[model samples]
Target: MTEMVRDNPALARFELGDGDALAVAHYRIADGAMIFTHTEVPRRLRGRGIATRLIAGALDSARARGLRIVPLCSFVVDYLERHPEADDRAD
Candidate 1:
């Protein structure tokens, strides 16, 4: 769908959607790394690939920022397993 995911720095998350339908990938930046801690897609929004797009965009943003990725969230870890091309970015 080419949804435009954006980083909400004040909230420490990569966000997609607006208002009550928001989907987010939460993270913390430290020591040149972006540590992903959680991901959430509204129940109504599940099964529509929203989380995939959100994570992909978040990883891309971290790469652009020259930050390594630390996927602490189970969702992120699973994403890495499913997308081996992203392996190089994770620690």
Candidate 2:
């Protein structure tokens, strides 16, 4: 399992196993939308679904704040493309 924590504004951190796996998604609030700039899951952690979890958590956070999402990150864009349900909150 992976652990996600909102470390601060515009950032969320995720971890898996005994390693410090991190997914860094950049965001900015504008016009009631959470404009996601980019997201990165370390190369070593790729294909493990950590990025998905991280994006999911970020979307959940946006939903909680009544904000829409604009997935600018290629990884996030690809993720949203596959998970249509998450696009409901996208701007």
Candidate 3:
């Protein structure tokens, strides 16, 4: 199933899905950059591409705002590494 990721600026995170299946990519904005600090997925949701969706959504939002990315989170770094198309958006 396709999940919808929502940016909760109040919480400084990009959220995906809901309830028990919810996942999040945590970030902080600084100097026109989105610094991705962490990513989390429920144990039951691992290896299901949920984290990938979350990162993609977060990156898309940053790109839409014309902000660069600082991927401090390991997962986000790896995602960017695998997707060269996103390099333009990264710092």
- Rank candidates by TM-score, best first: 3, 1, 2
The 10-residue segment of model 3 with minimum total lDDT is 82-91
Give the alpha carbon lDDT tens digit for every residue of 33-80 in model 2: 888777766888788777777788778888888888877778778878
Runs with alpha carbons beyond 4 Å of true place in candidate 2? 10-18, 89-91
Positional deviation of residue 49's Cα in model 2 after best superposition, in angstroms: 0.5
Clashing pairs in 2: none
Higher-ranked by TM-score: 2 or 3: 3
Q: What is the TM-score of each candidate against the true structure?
A: 0.91, 0.79, 0.91
Identify the runs in model 3 with alpha carbons over 4 angstroms from their true place: 89-91
Clash pairs detected, candidate 3: none
- Most TM-score-accurate candidate: 3
User: 17-80 in candidate 1: lDDT tens per residue?
Assistant: 8456999999999989999999999998899999999999999998888898899999999998
Q: Whose TM-score is higher: candidate 1's or candidate 3's? A: 3
lDDT (CA) per prediction: 0.89, 0.70, 0.88
Question: What local lDDT score does residue 27 receive in model 2, on the 0 to 100 scale?
Answer: 77
Q: Alpha carbon lDDT of residue 48, candidate 3?
A: 81
